[model samples]
Target: MDPNANKYLLFNKLSSQDAKKKLESETFKRTTLSFYKYVNLKDISFYRDYLYREWDKLKVLGRVYIATEGINAQISIPNYNIEKFKEQLDNDIYLKNISLKEAIEEKDFSFFKLIIKIKKRIVADGLNEIDFDSSKVGNHLSAGEWNDAIDKGAVIVDMRNHYESEIGHFKNAILPQSETFKQELPMVKELLSENKNDKILLYCTGGIRCEKASAYLKHNGFRDVNQLHGGIIDYKKQLMENPKLENKFIGKNFVFDERLSEKISEKVISFCHQCGSKCDMHINCKNMSCNLLFIQCKKCKEKFKSCCSTECKKIIDLSENEQKILRQGSINKNRFNSHRIIN
Candidate 1:
């Protein structure tokens, strides 16, 4: 029997700050990557715990969600242990031969700790299983094929939230204005009702949302539904590998990491929320109570002291104790629940 069988727990023990400090002090380089699959699992809890134990041994760090339907993962692993990590995945039945999408910009670490969560679904779209048959998804087009489709004037729809698209998206892509996937799914359906019969190309940060979305559209009777093979991340990878391919995406691709976005092209389509200057940087308000994620320019960041507004700046100025009291009683009416789209 292994003496340290129970040494690792199913949950992360260190605080995020502490974990980040540990990661910064690490000597070896780490690679950030993401992958997902819509495969069925008999025991999600067992698989989640098994993965946590195994990955923790390899010093892996990132967010992973496992459900009965599937598993979605975004993680960073030490360069030295990448092969070992791959071997671990290969040995596993569920994750074997899973395609990994490496981050374009790896200067900043994506995560500091490993977190395996059990959710009802891998990608939440606020729908029952009956809403859309996941098995009947759109055609997965390769990066080159996607480009060809775009050249052929196929209807392109950005299957991401407003914030995700506001930072970066393909040129002329139908950027949905919804806050969540649940809302965006129906909104997108109606937005393209007129073009239901046309060839539709859908994409997102990764291909998870589009997997569900494409099926939803097909269930609703849309014809010729197709999606970017592995979404923008994979598209960027394909473009990097092949120099001849033209990069159609503009501005930074908004990523859920310490490095907020990655450069897809040398273009800035969005502007600063405060000054209206050409900027695509997204920042959360310094005020903990009003932690609204919005775009701020370098000038406004300095002027507002990394806050969303003068009001939030004032709150941040208060003493820690005073701020606690305000948080206890005050309502965050000024905070924008959805992203602030300052176009």
Candidate 2:
């Protein structure tokens, strides 16, 4: 879709100050929520257009993806439009009974503009329906049930990538070292190769990844499998409601938003990738060509000017034209360890 076609998205390269000013001017509280469903939809194009037109009127702002397999959305709807939005969703059989996860911390500016795109798959598990039996998946555990299962010594595994789990994760959970959910599945299965029959627990940022992962594990002949119903976001809400509940997860829960993460606990399980200091502050490199998402401590932020490495920091001194010229021919250096480069 042509984003520029919309008046709301006419501006570009806006400063945070400008963005905050716009957000502050808004009168209503924006509720952030996400939901997904794995159902066949042959008319995805029509469905996409229908959603865009409907949500646009409600002045929604967030990212949404729909595919033949399913729909996944994380968006901010106006407080007044909450019931209307829910009603609209309920009106559609495809979206009916979908598990919508509300954000614990409702920031009005979770998104700047709305964007709904059509994709090949909602979650991109890198596997077709033929690869696994989604019909018979793992057990869904509530926050209370999840804690109980963990206490019972079930083998807990984090389904999120290393970058996400590095900052915050359920304590004593087996964290896979892979970068994507596609890679993490096999990594996790191999990691727990010995515990096929044992009660295996899985979780992700949202519960969606676990849905696919659990199904895959079950297809591979793992008898007992379970997933946290709403993932960490729901788990945090449960802890907040009942202060007496034990929060095994620590540090910030990495989120895909302007905030980057939300503070779930006091512990910092990760460190600054540059200075090796204990920190959970995730920052993208200031260099446009090397926007590597890595953890940086306060001191390192000051030291490197929010860049991932010394080379990236130096790149900022060059003219924009020069930087672009350099970026044109080279692969993204951030994908590899920038700090480890001998140059």
Candidate 3:
């Protein structure tokens, strides 16, 4: 057996569609969970390869980002092998006893295949790593403490994108309009410029973004910085485990998965982008050439055929060859961010 031959098997060979088919044919259930750590990794590739090999053996499938700063992962593991997977983590030097936040609304196929990639940072804030110490993050708060802080008039800031906060967030959170974490950090600072001395609470989909955000705030001289210990996912888990705690969060919690978003509360705080009807369901435009992501009600979904605009709808209606011709060297300025612009 040649070592290089086995090295070629490190990556997933199956296409996403085939991987989905294989996932559907599986008989066992899988659990979706997420975790992140800001520990230094000297050899990122070595660890990445190690994780891919080990997790592939356990039939784990999901997205994982590894950087010199840390690792951020959202993965689905086979229920039968979950214990063994946990054992594997426990044995690992870097990830031992790391906190894991299970998905609140888990689907059998949250992800189709495993994908581990190296990145510059686990959660990109665009801030120089040397400028801020990520380890000096804000004070961690539990669900009960978070509610108490809210009741006490602490400044609540949603660390996620504008689209995420549009669907659901803690009531009265200072939701920044920026679309990415890199833009949100400075926007958040400006949004709370006067509240530097005030108690500020930050949170994201998982705790990873907040970990960086809280540190950034602290570095920028914000006093009394705090964050949801495990972000919204863990907050929901805490709420489920303890009903006495008040659920300050409203509407659906937007997620980066096939399910799109999970119900955190019964309230629908957002409306469809097209008809303005009450809806929190998000979907990417069906037109591969212009995959704009936006909220669409069932009616609008059927009417538009999952396209974001009439122009996109016309393009999708064209023959395959015609569509190909249009796609050739075509520049879609509104490919992802301009759903509102095109609409």
Report the backbone clash tally of model 2: 0
* Model 1 weakest 10-residue run by lDDT: 329-338
How far out, in Å, is residue 32 in model 2? 1.7
| lDDT score for candidate 1 against the true structure | 0.88
Per-residue CA lDDT of model 3 for 142-206, tens digit only, reads 99999999999999999988888998999889988887899999999999999999999999888
Evaluated with lDDT, which candidate comes out highest? 1
lDDT of each: 0.88, 0.81, 0.87
Point to the candidate with the largest TM-score: 3
- In the range 218-318, model 2's lDDT, one tens digit per residue, is 98889999999888998998889988889888888877765667888988787777667788877777887877778788998898898877888898889
- The true-versus-predicted C-alpha distance at residue 144 of model 3, in Å, is 0.4
Model 2 score (lDDT): 0.81
Q: Record all residue pairs in model 3 with backbone atoms less than 3 Å apart, i.e. clashing.
A: none
Q: For model 1, how does the per-residue alpha-carbon lDDT over 1-343 read when each residue is reduced to its tens digit?
A: 9997966677888986899899889999999988998889878888888999899999999989999988999999999999999999899898899988888998688887898999998887888877557789999999899999999999999998888898899998999888888889889999999998999999998798999999999989999999998899989989989989999999888887767789889889888999999998888887777777899999999999998888889988999998988888544533335367533
Pull out the clashing pairs in model 1.
Answer: none
In model 1, which runs have C-alpha deviations exceeding 4 angstroms? 1-7, 328-338
Identify the runs in model 3 with alpha carbons over 4 angstroms from their true place: 1-4, 329-342
Comparing 1 and 3 on lDDT, the stronger one: 1
Q: Could you tell me which 10 consecutive residues in candidate 3 have the lowest summed lDDT? A: 333-342
